[model samples]
Target: MDAVGLSLMNEAVGGSEKCVSAVREAFGAAEALMIRNVSQVAKDFRCCQTPKDHQDQVELMQSLADIVMGTVQYNEESVLMSISDLCGVMTNQSAAYNEEREPYQRLVKLSQIYRSSSEEPCLDVSHEKRVKDLMDTTVQSERRAERQWTYQTCTEFGFYQTCEDASCPFSGMVTLRSQTEICLELFGISQNSLPGRVAFTNRYYGGDEPHAHRVLYVNGGVDPWKELSVGNRTDGGEEAESVFIRDSAHCADMSRGRVTDRRSLKNARQEIEKHVESWLKTAQQEKKRTE
Candidate 1:
């Protein structure tokens, strides 16, 4: 998700080092504000004592923090656009993109409000109302797919993008505990069971060192998820290949070839095509041998 933000930031700034630093500072400020709001909300929730059980209060905090972390993903278009608008303003390119854009205007208004008050603006989300709204909404097919994916994460793959690492660009509020608590809440999968489950999955599938043939492991340099993907295998026994596109973001090679694409990305796509062609030819040869 941070990769999405970084890619979008680079696009918006267009190589302006000044705008890059300014946009990073702006993102840090936004993260700080969100952390402050979540902290205040947690304190208020604990003190309110609205007949909720201790367990329920803890679950609510986890859920709320999960919501806050969701804004950091690419699914939240508004957050991405806000950052893009901030970048545009810093680079003096907002008018070039859209003269009628409202994001910059809204950002300006928000800045004005922040300047006028001694207290920082807080985003106060009503927990009860939020829960009610979610309950009242109808679940769609896309949401069903999401539920299935979430279950896989809880059961087999603990692929949670947490901010526990010091190098993570996001705030520390997005912890592994906050993510694991969701599994407990939804599927009765405790945090304690996650390690064993993930280990079993790795053992079953040979996680990083899979014994395979004609497999191409392609990854983008800027993509955070690439850390989990198979890179260069030292054994060099399998008919597998790895291509590292240093200038690309997530799934960049999956897109249609563009004239503006970096040379590394273009070469990577060609390499993937070569792998596919070789696999098809190998399959044809095996069919002839069987016949």
Candidate 2:
């Protein structure tokens, strides 16, 4: 999910204050499920310790780990959808406000000041133009400022780290007040605006990949880069490198396919955590071997 969408979900699930708890809950739930799956895989693999069986088990475990990672990606998408729904409601309300009889009369009066002052004296014109420009700039700045503020505020309230991006954080109640405060400060439109709240929401989600650093595969593949290329040089100065390239079709034969339901997702998460743990162990062993 984009930062904004994540924030909005944080809001919808439990208001801005409880956003942190909600996110933690979601993450924790997924983790627990993943752990369970890993345990089951381990139990099944433990019965077969023959060298050939061990090799098959290792491949199966890695595939299970991939499914867990996929679940994390899917959960992020689910959270984004929930946030989008909340944003839709806010947009409808804002549209209705524009059609209201006495909607923000103060801002309307301010607009008239610009419209009527167009033909005033050159000095007066220049001064008014300058003032208007300042106001416009201020409004834009404030809107941008507010977006930053709201993102931080949501983070502060929810206890989620503010996303590195200035526009939105990973979690919190992303409200219209927060959105408008950002827009007015940045863009200068108080009532009618292009793209509107949805635009803001899109910005929140669209920038998610860069923010999350989630891996993307070129094809429906798993661990295509699993085999690290380790180079060695002979005494004669000839170079050699070991590269293990798995057949993609053969790898697919090992996969369980994309699992999405909660049970499967939970299992996937566990499998991933197990694989990560195993990877860490292997890495440490390799380091020791090198040492």
Candidate 3:
């Protein structure tokens, strides 16, 4: 998900000239990705690919705007009026994206067109330009909020949300509120600049969907984020494997060992070492072949 690129946009607006170019390109890439995501789901997200109908698209965008605004503090409605307007721009961009995908998906061709104005294509270049510009604006605004949360309150904010949903040892709105005040004192930002609580809470939450064949997923049962992690539904097999330590802290296996380390942590680390060595063996064989 290009998390590094996303984090680089933390300066929000009026950053240094270097950040301006780097963030611009990074956001441009993300805007393309968002378009691809919406395209995969379509305007209504029903997995339909019919691009001719766009009346309902505007409403879908309004719903997204609602989701985006729901994360901010309530009193900032005045400032949100302008931010909400970017939803329309996103809608237009999504719609324009359809023009470049007729007969068959020419996403690559259209992407090239988006990258360079001089590239010739079988679609409206001017419309493509407009979509690109609007996407730039839309991405910049969303990323500004993301950057604020990333640099300021990401970890505690996520755990705080987990506490709100379930009992968490590190969870408490009091900490969040207190930290918000501290953030304001330390940095000139406010809670309003952070991404919505929903987005924040789901930051590390993922489904049990299958991943790479050799990938190893380690989860600690007591880990607050363990409530959501890859499943250990199957017995050991050739594909993906998950090692879950019910009593261990999150990511405890990755930490350097200590005599006081819990049994679960020790077991998890051994499993990790075994898997890593196996992967290295496979990689070395592949390298020998390539050589």
Model 2 ranges with Cα > 4 A deviation? 1-149, 152-180, 183-262
Tens-digit lDDT track of model 1 for 121-164: 43323444323343332575434555667779989988886656
Instruction: In angstroms, give how far residue 199 of model 3 lies from its true place.
Output: 10
Model 1 TM-score, all chains together:
0.64
Error of 3 at 123 (Å): 58
Q: Estimated TM-score per prediction?
A: 0.64, 0.19, 0.34
Question: Candidate 1 — worst ten consecutive residues by lDDT sum?
Answer: 70-79
Instruction: Give me the runs in candidate 3 sitting further than 4 Å from their true place.
Output: 1-206, 233-236
Which prediction has the highest TM-score against the true structure? 1
> Which of the two candidates, 1 or 2, achieves a greater TM-score against the reference?
1
Per-residue CA lDDT of candidate 3, range 120-201, in tens?
Answer: 3222212223233333435556345544454435333433331122222111222344334333443455666545643544
- Report the candidate with higher TM-score, 1 versus 3: 1
Please give the lDDT score at residue 192 for candidate 2.
44
Those runs of model 1 whose alpha carbons end farther than 4 Å from true positions after fitting are 1-142, 234-238
Evaluate model 3: give its TM-score: 0.34
**Candidate 3, residue 145: lDDT:** 55
Give the alpha carbon lDDT tens digit for every residue of 246-275 in model 2.
Answer: 212112322454543234334444544555
Q: Model 2 lDDT vs. the true structure?
A: 0.32
